[model samples]
Target: MTMQDSTDLPRDTSRVDSLEDKSLLLVDDDQPFLNRLGRAMERRGFEVRTASSVGEGLAEVRRAAPAFAVVDLRLEDGTGLDVVQALHGAREDARAVMLTGYGNITTAVAAVKLGAVDYLAKPADADDVEAALLARPDALPEPPENPMSADRVRWEHIQRVYELCGRNVSETARRLNMHRRTLQRILAKRSPR
Candidate 1:
């Protein structure tokens, strides 16, 4: 089509709208993940702000409630749900998403009740976050392009428990109901690809 015809043909100007107020708050205790996600979101047209703890996230919310948020379930100081709640309290129109490495039914339900638009497991990519933030109320999100493999999920679970138990092999093994030696062996191996 000619340039003038192309201009007349309806153009998707979603990215152009990024110049508008698309402030986003991201809270996670994981330093690397937080930084990476922040940069990715910025590239996707969001004015990204980040915090590493519940306290920081609350402070950011108090300063100004963002249009969107992605918060971790557990923080060093408190639960990320606190941030989500505060954001909703500040701005009723804010859309929030909860993130967790340790996902469970109760917490997911709680996130929804607290006004979160969606709940996502840890290791979620930038695309997933963007889709959730901008999704229409009546639309369902598309599935992830690359979901975690079963082995990877198992590995992540073991790793989370191991960290939660303060890296005490015996305790993690006991909690997981696996033999200490087996737990040790799994820990020793590299995470599945």
Candidate 2:
């Protein structure tokens, strides 16, 4: 069983609607992540609406532009930069922050060129995201306080490759040049610190 085993609970939107300049759009392919982050942002005074794909995110933006956005760089269907561009087209003043488990220099630069205000590596908290989204354009956001453990970086890289290979263990092993059983063991274990 998972945290999302029950999806019948209703989300309360009344209090969310009453807050102005606090509307947010959160886009990620991971449903549990979107749900958890949505609630967290709401706790910090944001009226949160979430989407799990670039198409859905674009649709949501067309329906209603948000004051802020936290977008996952890689969606199941397409890149989150598409959503950022759409949001900027709808409302140029909207602030957007990009998140990725596979953060790279090229993608970060592309995201910025597409109008995202900031790029963040994943496992980021709502506070970090909020700060980036709300920070002044001229100011540089503070660097990450803690360095990622080498094992954690390896775990994140493996996960990213696994996802890219459509979760196929054999394909991921081939790409990573590891034996199939070794890849399986890594995938089954909890993420390293």
Query: What C-alpha lDDT values do all the predictions have?
Result: 0.87, 0.85
Off by over 4 Å in 1: 1-19, 143-193
Task: Kindly list the per-residue Cα lDDT of model 1 for residues 1-193, writing each as its tens digit.
Answer: 6457665787543322343579999999999999999999989888989999999999999998999999999999999989999999999989999999876555777899999999988789998788778777666556766777899879878887897799999999999999999999999998775
Q: Summarize candidate 2's per-residue lDDT along 18-96 as a digit string, tens digits.
A: 3258789999988888899999888988889999999999999999999989999998898999999999999998989
Return the TM-score for candidate 2, rounded to 2 decimals: 0.66
Candidate 2, residue 172: Cα displacement in angstroms equals 22
lDDT of 2 at 106: 59
Runs of candidate 2 with Cα error greater than 4 angstroms are 1-20, 146-193
